[model samples]
Target: MKAINPKTKTNWEAIGVKPHIEIPQTNALDVAYKMALNEVKKSVSDEHQIKDINDKLEELSNSLPLKEK
Candidate 1:
């Protein structure tokens, strides 16, 4: 009996394989956080409010560890 090679004869579609789907690389939390930050910056016109926002952003950024290359 001859053995069939699975790699060369596999029907990907028959197994419900999908190649058209695109996955996002960015974290959803990061995207939502940036959107919220932008909206906050746009709505705050007072110097103190802007300063407070900047301070909070700086504090949060400093709290996270840097990613190594």
Candidate 2:
């Protein structure tokens, strides 16, 4: 297997390392993928809540006027 770092143009052999390894079991990989997907979904929900808070803050700021300078 060929391993190259694009930025540094270095090979794994040059770094004194082996790049190829055994593949992961299918069941373990599937479970990890599912967990990652759930985390991403939770993140998206949190982002929506943040956006709502920001919108409310902007509305409140617009409603209140600053004292004349």
Candidate 3:
């Protein structure tokens, strides 16, 4: 009597998450929020996500709401 594991599929490509995913939008009160996010990221386990967050901060810093004539 031989038993097969359902998790061990012959074709795994079709079981994983979908490709071409879209990221969610985030809102912050001000630069303080970005700073807080950075601080919190130090404790997280993921590094790639942290880098994405840091890049987001850079974008926010570059954007300006007020314009000069």
Candidate 4:
């Protein structure tokens, strides 16, 4: 590696400088992929439960009185 000189260059040393080793960066795509997988897992688990929730919401909405107020 070429030696860096403060007088000849900027006063900062920017190469190979890490305070601590960190985990590799995961970008937005990685986060989105994980979230989608989680949602799919939840949706696939006990489909009857999801159906029951939808049925209850439908019943509640149907029983409500609509007003133009």
Candidate 5:
């Protein structure tokens, strides 16, 4: 592993290695992070909802009268 220093960074333009590719100013990593965060939040919310539904079902089952065979 090598550490990259800003002062010793290679200049792609000076080396005549100009790539025709155009990069967007937007940070893709930040976008991905935000998307992942949102998914985690949604998953947590879904878990809570499922737990609440299960708790309600248990209560309902307990309130029902048992039938003898």
Candidate 6:
């Protein structure tokens, strides 16, 4: 059996090859931690974007003239 290259999705090693490029496998806990970290990063990014949009909207509202009813 030959190990397949991840990038090109082809077998770079010759047939009956041993000790090819080793691909590190992650455990379930490691995968879950990475996924949670990504979600947290995305959430923080979304919060900052929302805050910026709100600030811009408030500035625009303040600049506009209001009329008495």
State in Å the error of residue 43, model 3.
1.0
1-69, model 6: which lDDT tens digit per residue? Answer: 756779867885555435432323433344344445545555565777657655654554454343113
- Among all windows of 10 consecutive residues in model 4, the one with the lowest summed lDDT is 60-69
Candidate 3 global CA lDDT score = 0.58
Candidate 3 clashes between residue pairs 3 or more apart in a chain or in different chains: none
* Model 3 steric clash total: 0
* TM, every model: 0.41, 0.30, 0.41, 0.30, 0.30, 0.30
lDDT of 3 by residue, 1-69 (tens): 334447864443546544342223332254455666778888867889888878886776666342223
RMSD (CA, angstroms), candidate 4: 16.2
Off by over 4 Å in 1: 1-35, 66-69
lDDT of 6: 0.50
| Superior by lDDT: candidate 1 or candidate 4 | 1
* Tens-digit per-residue lDDT, 5-64, candidate 2: 898787867466542432345444444444455455555657776576556545544543
Model 6 misses residue 34 by how many Å?
A: 37
Candidate closest to the true structure, highest TM-score: 1
Clashing pairs in 2: none
Q: Which of candidates 1 and 6 is the stronger one according to TM-score? A: 1
Kindly indicate the candidate among 3 and 6 with the higher lDDT: 3
In terms of lDDT, which candidate is stronger, 2 or 4?
Answer: 2
| TM-score of structure candidate 2 | 0.30
With a 3 Å backbone cut-off (N, CA, C), the pairs that clash in candidate 1 are none
> Alpha-carbon error at 65 in model 4, in Å?
1.6
Q: Give the TM-score of candidate 4.
A: 0.30
Please give the RMSD to the true structure for each candidate, in Å.
11.6, 17.5, 12.8, 16.2, 19.3, 18.6
Point out where model 3 deviates above 4 Å. Answer: 1-28, 64-69
Give the distance in Å from residue 42's predicted Cα in candidate 1 to where it truly belongs.
Answer: 2.0
